[model samples]
Target: MALSQTGIRRWYLVHKWTSLICTAFLLLLCVTGLPLIFHHEIEELTGAHSSIEQVAGGGTASLDTMVEDAKRRAPAQVPGFLFWDSEKPLVAVVTASSLTDQQNIVIHYYDARSGAHVPAPPHDEGVMAFLLDLHKSLLMGLPGTLFLGLIGLIFAVAVVSGVVVYAPFMRKLAFGTVRKDRSPRVRSLDTHNMVGIVTLGWVMVVGLTGLILTMATPIALIWQIDELSEISAPYEGKPPPTRLASLDTAVAAARAAAPGGQKLSSVAWPGTMFSSKHHYMIAFSGETPLTERLIHPAFVDAETGRLTEIRDMPWYVKGLFLSVPLHFGDYGGMPLKIIWALLDIAAIVVLWTGLRLWFGRRRVPIEKRVEELRGGGVPEPAE
Candidate 1:
C-alpha cells in the first residue's frame, strides 16, 4: 500500500535513526556471522575436529565408560551433561566445578564406538569460538546477548522503514536500477536501496532469528519455572538423588520412553538446571536437520533408573529450536550455506552504502529530505 507524503516523511526519520543506531552492531554481526555459517566445515578443515573410528560391529560403547573417561580427564570437575556429536560418532561430557558454574567448563570427547579419549581442541579456545562469542554476546554473557537482540529489533524497524520510504522513491524508477549518471551520493543511494530490497527477506530472517536466540536464557528460565516445576511437582521436597542409578540404565529407560525414530542427543545429569533434582533429563532429536533442532525430552528417575515421563517442548521453546537452523542456514547443507554467505555479503554492501550516504547527505531541512524522497528535489552532491 502506498503511504502519504507525511507518512513517508515519518517513516524516513524512523528509517534514518534506526539504521544509524544499529548499523554498526549489525555490521559486526554480519561480518562475524559469515564464518559461523560454515562453522562445522571450518572446524573439520582446520583439523581441530576429531574423527570417530568405526568399530567392526557398529556398536557404541556404554555411556558409563564415556562418563568415566571424562571424569578421569577432569578429576576435579563434576559431570554436568553428556551429549553426542550430531555429525560424528563422538560423545562428549561437559564438566565443571558445579552444575551452576558457567566458567572454566571443560568438554571431554570420546569415540562412541571404542570409548577411547579423543583429543580435540577445547571448544572455548579458538578463533571461530571467539568470533561466535562476539557475534552472539560480545563476551558479556546474557546481558550482551539481550543487548544484541534489542539491536536486532531496531534493525528490523530500520529495514521496514527503509522499505516504506524507498517505495515512494522507486515509483519512478525501474526495480534494481542504479543510476551512474547521477552524483556520487545519488548513485550510492540508489545502490543501497537496490541491494537492501534484494536481500530483504534474508536479512529479516537472520535478524529475527538472532533476536530469538538472544532470548534463550530467559526462555529456559521460563520453562524451568513453568513446565519444569510442574514436571517436578510429584517429587516435591525431595532432595537430589544421593546415589544415582547407572548412566546406562537411565539412558536405556529414557530411550524406551521416547518415540521410535528419535535418537538420544544429550543427557542433563540430575541437579543441573536442565534436569530435575530427582530425575535425569534426556533430550532426543530426529534424524533430519529440521527435526534435530526440535528437541523432545524424557525424564528418568535418578535413583531407580525408571522412566518418569516424556513430553514435547513447549511452543516457545520449539520456536527457539526452529530459529537455530534457520538462523545458521545449517539445515539445508552446503548449498544453503553458500547462498546465505552471498546474501550476507550483499547485506554488508547495503549497510556500507547506507552509512556512506548518511555521512555525505547534505545538511537540509526535513522538508528538503521529504522532497528528495518524493523524487523531485535533487540531493546535493556528496559533501
Candidate 2:
C-alpha cells in the first residue's frame, strides 16, 4: 500500500535524518568490518598465526606440562585461564599479576600436540587487531563501544524507514530501476535505494548483533553478581586453593562430565572472576555449527578435580555468545565469509550514494521529492 502524502513526508524525514546521522559511522563499520570478515584467513596470509603440525599416533601434549612452561616464562604472573584456539591446533595460557589485573597480562601459546612453545604474535601488535579494535570499539574502549551501539540502533531505524520510503519511491519505477538519463543526483538516489533494499536483511542482522555485543561488559558484570553468585554460594566461605590439582585432571574430569559432542573451550582457574575460590570453571563448546558458539560451563573442585556442577548459561549470555559468529560470519567457513564481505561492500556503496544524494546542491523541497516519487522520472533538477 502506498503511504499518504503526510505519511510519506514524515517517513522521508525520518529516513533522511536517521541515515544522515548514522551514515558516516555505518560506512566506517562496513569498511572495517569487511576485512574482519576474513580476519582468520588474513592472519594466515600474513603469517601472524602459527600452525601446529599433527603428530603421529594421534598423541597430544599434557596440559600440565604446557602450564608449567607458561609459568616458567612468566614466573611473576599467575595463570588465569587455559584456552583452546578454535581455528588452529594451538593452546593459549593467559597470565597476569592477578585475575583482575587489567594491565601486565601475558599470553603464551603452545603446540597442542607437542607442547612446543611458540612466540605467538601479540594481539595488540597486528594490523588485523587494530582494525578489529576500531571496528568493535573505535579504539576508545567501552565508551566508544556504547556509542557505536547507539549508532547501530539508529542505523536500524534508518533501514526500516528507508524501506517505508522505498515503497512509495518505487511505486512508478520498476524494481531495481535506475534512471541513467536523469541527473547524477537522481541516479545516485536510485542506486542508493536499490542497494539499500538489496542489503536490508544483512544490515539489520549485523547492526542488531553489534548492538548486542556492545553490552557485553555490563552483561558479564550482571552475570557475575547474579547467576555467578548463586552458583558459587556453596563455596562462599572457602579459601583459595593452596595446592591446585593437575590441569590434565581438571580437564579430564570436565570432559568426562560433559555431554556428547562437546569439547573443552577454556578453563578459568579457581579464584578468578569466572570461577569460585575453590573450583575451576571449565567451559565447553559443541561440535555442530550452531552450537559451537553457545558454551556451557562446569565447576570442578580445584584440589580434587571432581566435577561439582555443570550449567547452561542464561539466555542473555547465550545471546551474547551466539552473536559472535553470526556477526563475523565465521561459523560457516569461507563461503559465508565471502558472502558477508560482498554484502559489506554493497552496504558501503549504499551509504556513499545516500551521502551523495544528501549533499547535492540545489536542494529539492520535500513536496517536490514526493511529487517526483509519484510521477516517476520527474524532469532533472535545475543545476
Candidate 3:
C-alpha cells in the first residue's frame, strides 16, 4: 500500500511538531522512570527503612489501639487513615494530618501487635522520595503533573504520526532493517526507524498509560462529583462528629452489612476527602484481578457505628486504579519486571535517535524532503 503525497506531508508535519514539543520531557520521563522500575530494590539495598523492624512474635494489634498510639506519637496531628502493609505483617502505617493545616500530613508507623511507634524507614525521607516526587510531579506538584500529562498527549500524537510515516518508510525495505553501510544521516535515520519499530508497542502502552496517570487528580475529582457528592448528599449539612465510634466496631458493622464476597479492607475516617465530614468511608476492594482495581465506598455514620450505604465503584475510577500497576509493571512477578526494564531501555534509545535524526536533518528544498519521505528514504548521495 502506498501513502498519497498529501497524506505524507500532513503526517510529517504532525510528527515533526509533536515530536519537537514532547521529546525533551519524554527523555526526562524515560531517564527518571528507569530508576522507578527498580525503586523498591534500590530502597531495600540502601536500607531506607531498615530502622523499622518487625516486632518479635509477629502478632497483630487492634486498629483502635494503634490510632490512639499514633496520636500520642504525633500529638498535634489528627488521624486520617489506617492501612495494612502486605510486606510487613507486624507494621501498620497511620497517616495523620495537622490539626490546623489540612495540607500537612505526617506518616507514622506502628508495630501492628504492640501498637508502639516504629521509626519510618530513612528512604521515606531521602533520595527515593525525591526521585518519586521528581518523576511524578517535577517537584512543582499538580501543575507539573498536568504539564507532563499534556506532554504525554503530544507524545501520543507523535507516536501515531510516526506510525503513519513508518508504514510508508518501510514499504520499500524489510521491517526493522537498518542500513549500516550508508552515511551518518542514513544510519541515524535507520537506527531511529528500527528502534522505533521494535519499541513501538511498548512506548504506546507506556505513553498512553503514563498519560492516564497524569490525569489521576482530575479523575478523582470527577469521581468525587459523581460518586462522593451523591453518596454523601444526605449528610451534606450535618456537622462532623466529635466522638466517632471505635474503628474496630465500625469495621465489624461494615463487614456485617457488606454484600456477599465484598470485604471491607481499608477505612477513611470522618473529616477526610475519602469520606464525608459526618461518616466513615469503608472501602471494599475485590479479590479478582479486575475488580480489585476499584474500591466500593461504604458509608457508615461516624456517631452510630452503623452502615448506611455501599455503592459500586464507577468504571472510570476503576480504570484509574487499574492503570497504576500496569503503568509500573507491578502485577506480574520478577519475569514481567525484567521485560518492562528491557522495553524501557529500548524506548530510551528510540527517543535519543529520533531526536538526533530530527535535529541533524539536512536543510534542503521542502519538495525534495517530502519526496524522500514519500519513499522509505533517500539515497545517501541524494542529501
Candidate 4:
C-alpha cells in the first residue's frame, strides 16, 4: 500500500518535532555511555583497582575477621555492609554512612591467607567518581534521570515516525538510495531516512533499554513497597543477631538445597535487604544459558545456617534480571559492543540530519510560503 503525500508530510512533521526536542540530551547520553561501556577495562588499565587473593585449602575466612580488619583500617567508622565474592574468596566491607558524611568507605584489600590488609595503588577519585556520576544521573540525581528517560521515549517515537515516513519517501527510490542529484534538502532527507531505517532495530533496542534503566529506581521502589515488604513481613520486628553465623556455612547449605549441582555464587550479609535478617541470601547459578544468568536466592537461617527458602524469582524479577545484559550489550562480547557503538554513532547522524532538514524546510521564500499556506503550490525550501 502506498501512503498519500499528505500522510507522508504529517509523519515527517512528527519526526521533525520529536527529534528536535530530544537530540541534544540524547547526544549527551550517548557520549557519556560510550566510555562507561569499558569501565572495567579502564579500571584495570589504570592500575588503581585491587584484586583479593584466594586462600588455599578451600577454607574461607570468617566475616568477623574481615570486619575487624576493615575497622582497624578505618577506626572511626562502623561497618555498614559486607559483600563476598565466592569465586575469588574476596570480602569487601563497606564502612561509609552517607556521601556527605565525613566517614567514607575505604575499601581494604585483603589476602585471605593472613587476613592482612594489603596496600593498594593510589586511585584518582576525582576522575572515576565524576565519570560514574555522569553515567548514572548526570549529577542531577532522580530528576535528571527521569528527564533523560523522557528524551529516550521521544527518541523511540521519532524513530517509529521516521520509519513510517521512510516508506512513502522510498516508494520511488530503492533501498539504500540517496537522491544526491535532487535539491539539497531532498538529498539531506534521503540520507537521514536511509541511515535511520537501516539502524532501526539497534537504535530501538538501545533506546528501550535506556528507558528501562532509567526507571530502575522507581520500579525497584514499587517492588520493594508492594511485593518485597509483604514477603519480608513474616520476619519483621525480630532483632538481628549480635553474633553473625559463618558465611561459608550458609554457602554450603544453599548449594546443597539447589535442585541441580548449581554452585553458590555470592552472599549478601544481614542488615541489608539483599541479605535476610535471619539468614544469608546465597545466590546460585546453573550451567545452562537460561539458568546461568538466573539467580536463585536461597535464604539461609542466620542462627543455624539452614536453608529457609529456595524459591524462584517472579516473572517481572526475571525480566529485570535479563534486561541488564540486553541494555549493556554485554552478552555478545566486544565485537557486538563495537557494532552497538557504531549504531549509536549512526543514530546521532540521523538526529543531526533530521534537524537540518526540518530547519531547511522552515525557511521557504515568502511567495512559496504563501503558496503552501494556500495548498496550491510546491513547498519551497527555506533560504
Candidate 5:
C-alpha cells in the first residue's frame, strides 16, 4: 500500500531525526572501520606481521613449548588465554595476566613450528589498537560501548524510515536517478536517496549486526550466568585449585571431548571470570563455513585434567560471534572486502548528501520541504 502524504511526513521526520542523531558516530565508524578492513595487510606491510613459511614436513609443534616460552617470558604473570591466528595457525598468541596489576596482561607470540618467540603484533598502545579501541568503545569503556550500540539502533531506525519514504519520493523517478541538472537542494536530495536505496540491504545488515556486536558484554554475561553456571554448578564457590593439572593435559582432554573437525580457538584458565574456579574453559570452532561461529565449550577439571562437560553455544552467543566478524567485513576474502569498502563509501556519500539537504532546508518553509519530498522541485538555500 502506498503511504499517504501525512504518512510520508511522519516517516520523513523519523528518517531525518534518526539519521541526524547517528550520522556523526556512523561517520567515525566508517572512517575507522575502513582501515580496519585492511588491518592485516597493513600489518604485513608495516612489519607488524610476517609471512609464515611452512615447514618441510608439515609437522605440528608442541603446544607445551609455546606455553612454556610464554611463561618464561613473563615469569611474574599467570597464564590466562592461549589462541592461534586462524589465518596463520603457525603463530600462537599466549596471554599472561599480571601478578601485581590485575589490569595488565602480557601477550607473547611464538612460532608454532619451531617454538621461537616471534614479535607480537601491535597492541594496546599502537595505532591500530587506538583505532580499534575507538571503534569498539570510543575510549569510554562500558558507557561508550553502550552509547555506540544506541547509535547503531538509531541507524537501524534511520534505515527503515528512509526505505519507507524512498518509495514515495521515487514514485516518479527512475531507479538510480540523480538529478544533476537541478537546484543544489534537489541534487543533494537525489544523491542522498539514490545512494541510500542502492546500498540499503548492505547498510541494514551491517548496521544491525554492528548493533548486536556492541551488546557483546551483555550476551557474554548471559552465557556465563546461564549455561556456564549450569556447567560449573558442581564447582561453585570452590576455592581455586592450588595444584592444578597440566594445561596440555586439560587441552588434550578437551580435544578428546570435542567433536572431530573442530579446532581449538582459545582457553580461559581456571579462576578467570569466564571460567570456573575449578575448571579450565576451552573453546573450539567448527571446521565448516557456517558452523564456525558456533563455539563448543569444553570444561576440564583444573586439578584432575578430566573433561567435565562439552556443550554447544546458545543462540545469543552464536549471534555475538557471527556479528563481530560480519560487522568488520573481514570474514570473506579480499574481493568481499573490496565490495564492502565500496558500499561503505556509498553509505558515506548518502550520509553527506542527507546532511546537505537537511542544512539546506533550514531557511525554506516546512510546506515546501514536504512538497520537495513529494516531487523533485529545487528549493533555494536560505543562507
Candidate 6:
C-alpha cells in the first residue's frame, strides 16, 4: 500500500526535527569518538612514556615504599589511591582532597626500579582531552552529559522512525535505486533514505550503546546505595583495621572463594568502594566469551580478609559492562573497528546531507516570500 502525500510529509517533518535537534551533539560525539577508538594505537605510535616496565622487578613492590616516594614528591598532599598497571608494571599514587575545592591530581610516571618520579612526555592533550570531553558531555559537566543522553534517546527514536518511513519511501522504487534524473528534492530524499537505511543496524547499536553509557553514573550510584550498602551492612560502624592488610592475602582469599573455574586478578580497597570498606572487591575472569568479560566481584571482610560473598552480577551491572565493548567497538578486533569507523563516517555524511536539505528547503518555502527593501529586487529560488 502506498503512503498518502500527507503521510509522507509528516514523516519528512519527523525526520527533519529529530535529526536537527540531535545532529550537532551527535556529530561532535561521533567525531570525538573516532579518534578515541584509536587512542591506544596513537599513544603507542607517539612513544609516550606511560610504563615503568623496564624498571619493575617481577614481584609486587611494597605499597609503603611507593607511598613514601609519592609523599616525598608532594609532601603537602595525601595519597588517594594506588593504581597498579598490571600490564605495564607501573604504580601510580593518586592524590586528592576530601573536599572538591582542589582539582584532583595524578602524578604519574614513577619508576618502580629506582622509585623515582619521572616526567611524563608531552603529546597532544588538545586532541585527546577535547575528544574525551566531547564524548563525556562536551566539557559541560553533568548537565551537558544529561543533555547528550537525551539527544541519544532522540537519535534512537529517529533511527526507528526512519526505518518505518523507509519501507513506504522504497515501496514504489527498487532497492539500491538512485533517481539521478529526478527533481532535486526527490534525489536528495532518495540518497538520504538509501544511506540511512543501509547503515541502520550499525547506527542503532551505536546509538543504544551510547544511551546506556550516559546512564552509567546513575546506575552505579543506585547499585552503591542499595545493593552495596545492604551487602556491607554487617560491617557498619566497625573500625577499619589499624594495620593495612596484605593485598596478596586478599587476592588469595578472593581466588579461593570465587567459583573454582575462574581466575582472580586484582582487589579493590575499602574507602575506594571499587573495594568495599569491609571486604576486598576481587575481579574474576573466565575462559568463555560471556564469562571472561563479566566481572564477578567477591566482597571479603576487610579486617579478617575472609571472603563473604561470591555471586552473579545484577542485570544492570552486567548490562553496563556489556555495553562498553559494544559501544567502543573493542569486542571485535581491528577489522570490526574499521567497520565501526566507516559506519561512523557514513553517519556524519547523513547528518551533513540532512542539514543541507533542511537549509535548501528553508531558502524558498512555496508559501513564503522575502520582503523587498526600497528599490531592491527580491531574490528568487534557483531554477
Best by TM-score: 1
lDDT of 2 by residue, 120-192 (tens): 6766678898898899899988799999989988988898988888887787788888888878888898898
Using all chains and alpha carbons, the TM-scores for the candidates as numbered come to 0.95, 0.92, 0.90, 0.80, 0.91, 0.81
Global lDDT of each candidate: 0.85, 0.83, 0.75, 0.66, 0.78, 0.66
lDDT of 6 by residue, 364-383 (tens): 56332111111111223354
lDDT of 5 at 239: 75
Which lDDT tens digits does candidate 1 get at residues 1-383? 67788888889999999999999998999999999999988888654244664434334688888888888888999999988877677788899999877777998887777777888888888899899999999999889999998998899899989988888887777888888787777788889989999888888888898899999989988999988888889988877788989999998888877888888799998878887888889999998887888889898999999998999999999999999988999878799999999999999999999999788665545676687888633454434
Residue 253, candidate 4: Cα error in Å is 2.5
Point out where model 4 deviates above 4 Å.
1-9, 47-61, 76-91, 98-128, 182-184, 259-261, 273-277, 287-292, 359-361, 364-383
**TM-score winner between candidates 4 and 5:** 5
> Best-fitting candidate, measured by lDDT?
1
Off by over 4 Å in 6: 1-8, 46-93, 99-103, 107-126, 239-243, 260-266, 273-275, 287-292, 363-383
For all predictions, the C-alpha RMSD in Å is 2.0, 2.2, 2.9, 4.6, 2.6, 6.6
**Ranked candidates (TM-score, high to low):** 1, 2, 5, 3, 6, 4
Model 3, residue 115: C-alpha shift (Å): 2.9
The model with the greater lDDT, 2 or 3, is 2
lDDT of candidate 1 at residue 100, scale 0 to 100? 78
lDDT of 3 by residue, 1-383 (tens): 57799989999889988999988887887788877887767766665245556544444467788787778777877888766543454444345454223345666666666667766563346777788878888888889999999998888999989888888777778877888887776787788888887878877888888889999889877876777777668876777688989887887778787777764456777767677777788887776765666678788888999888888777887777888877888567678878888888888888888777777666555676577677667544354
TM value for model 3:
0.90
Roughly what TM-score does model 2 have, to 2 decimal places? 0.92
